[model samples]
Target: MGEFKVLEIKQSIFEDNDKDAEAVRAELKEKGVFLLNLMSSPGSGKTTTLCRTIELLKNQLRIGIMEADIDSDVDAKTIAEQGVKSIQLHTGGMCHLDADMTRQGLKGLGIEDVDLAILENVGNLVCPAEFDTGSVKNAMILSVPEGHDKPLKYPLMFSICDVVLINKIDVMPYFDFDLEKCKEYIAMRNPNAKVIPICARTGEGMEEWAAWLKEEVNEWQTN
Candidate 1:
């Protein structure tokens, strides 16, 4: 009976998480807020990509961000300077941010007031893949310096991602990162995933990303 009680407790927690995630998504939909959960490994330039995206879309859309980090305030401060409303989430050394933590962060984000809310997950490739933060879309950025094997090595993130942003394309000549191979791997894992090559620093692929986002938002608006 004791073991059965613990199992019941665990089951209840899992069920509760799923229910909460659904509720959060429904609420965001009603508010017309398109939430995107961005995930990537450390140094993959997730924050830089976000800042660039926000800058590009700010004039057209009310952009907001929920920045998740283990300790450093660098990313949050830098994002806030760009004139977008961003809430910093300090995970206190947790490798991944669960739906509950994200719920707390979203409660503080005032998401209903914005058109789009981007959740930048703690810079982690693997663990973040195992969790859902009640986002409308899951975006993953893979930098050229990270090598092409990332999709194969960290399959879950790629598999679950709605879109794959290939960052640091300018560094393609310097690094051995093959964009074609990366696309192939991503396709193998997620055959339907849209892959966009981008140089976040130079804003090369910002337009394409923005266009994709606009399409998604338009569809949401109509449906």
Candidate 2:
């Protein structure tokens, strides 16, 4: 028989990442920094939503943004124009940000002075959900054009997120997207998850989204 070396590679990788994630989370907590790992598909309006969020809370929090992409500083530039601290993280062709990578981004962004650090993770569903980035909370956005069946196709992403934003709701009339069905799908996968519908372009439903964020940040800081 040929020699067989069983590595259990996937299991080992996850275990190692989990340890690093815990350490990163502890360090951030001790520094009073609330990190949010935001994930979504490309063109889901994550940057626009983030811009709206920054506008709403910039006065209340020392906000910082880490825009992770395979290669692009556009989002970082957009965030910087909002007058908040921003950094662009090139993932070197990788599709996700693991704990160590996230820690490095935080260092670049000077997270110690940031009360709220939002990591706009690589624009993908599969890879980002599989790895923990040591964020205080994980959020994903599902635009109405993406359809409600996403939760069924990407259950792990839906299951792991603390909150899910249903973006581009203003176009809900044009698309075949069913809002209730989407909510049902998310609830089935993650009952504890908070789902907020918003049209990031027009600022519709932003107040609710901002309120939830404010509450979460407050809780993260005090606890």
Most accurate candidate by TM-score: 2
User: Per-residue CA lDDT of candidate 1, range 176-221, in tens?
Assistant: 8888989999999999999999999999999999899978876765
Per-model TM-score, in order, reads: 0.93, 0.95
Residue 90 displacement in candidate 1 (angstroms):
1.0
**Deviation (Å) of 166 in candidate 2:** 0.3
lDDT of every model, 2 decimals: 0.87, 0.95
Which candidate has the top score in lDDT? Answer: 2
Off by over 4 Å in 1: 1-14
Count: clashes, candidate 1 = 0
lDDT of 2 by residue, 80-136 (tens): 999999999999999999999999999998986899999999999999999999999
Q: For each candidate, how many residue pairs have backbone atoms clashing (under 3 Å)?
A: 0, 0
